[model samples]
Target: MTKNFDRLLEQSLDELSVQYKTLYHDSDIEGMKPLAHVDCTVLKIHGDYRDTRFRNITDELSSYPESVNELLNRVFDEYGLIVSVWSANGIPLYAM
Candidate 1:
């Protein structure tokens, strides 16, 4: 069964927001927001280190550990979602 964009967006935003808040060290930070496309989503961490420590952590493709893919796939399998995290400047980080 295919899920709609609203449902997918709500699910992703709810689950990942808290995790990112802690990871980025900013209470307002939320990761993985829905893009304009129907099925696309992007990680929403800012590039400013003063606001978040995730810059170095998410700078390279290797920064996202294999476990992230495994977890995201496992958790979001119902929606057939493949996460693609992008930098603030629009660099693709990792996809899985």
Candidate 2:
């Protein structure tokens, strides 16, 4: 991946890590492993979480500000991977 793509992926991973930690305080290794695989650009949630899976995140980013979306989309469109997102639950969310 290009430097810009790497930076964007890192940023997205960081953001998800924080959010995952906050959402699942009692999360275990299994629960956390999926977080490492999430494709922030494509918003793909992959893992064995019962309640979590690769959820279509194309629109989810809309919740963020325009600037954030632009940056995220730029990276996602360029190098987003179609992978699984980590979830405290077992089911992985999928893109719609």
Candidate 3:
């Protein structure tokens, strides 16, 4: 990633309080740096509890934001998803 884009991603991750986006590196003195061990990106499709934002029963069939949609699309197309879904009515669906 470009340096500028890296900073931007870090800023956005911080704004969302995403704990996985960064780590306190022993080699780095400037504080937390982007996680470099793996190319893992965590998507909050179910929303975040820190800000008390979550998807409800009604939201089960609702569309996600464009950005989320794009990521979801790209992830399914590229990295693949291992999902365990809870139905709107609270039924447990097997992971795929």
* Candidate with best TM-score: 3
Q: Name the runs in model 1 displaced over 4 angstroms.
A: 1-51, 56-59, 82-96
- The order by descending TM-score is 3, 1, 2
Q: Which lDDT tens digits does candidate 2 get at residues 1-96?
A: 221112344466576674322121112223433434543222322212233431225663235445434544655676554544434685767532
RMSD of 1: 11.8
Candidate 3 residues lying further than 4 Å off, grouped into runs, are 1-19, 22-38, 57-61, 85-93
Q: List the residue pairs that clash in candidate 3.
A: none
Give the C-alpha lDDT of model 3.
0.46
What lDDT would each prediction earn against the true structure? 0.39, 0.37, 0.46
Which one is best on lDDT? Answer: 3
TM-score of each: 0.25, 0.25, 0.44
Model 1: lDDT of residue 28: 28
Q: Write the per-residue lDDT of candidate 3 for residues 1-96, one digit (tens) a residue.
A: 111112444566578776543221212213423334435454445543343344545755276566556545765776776665556697987657
Tell me how far the alpha carbon of residue 12 in candidate 2 is from the true structure, in angstroms, after superposition: 14
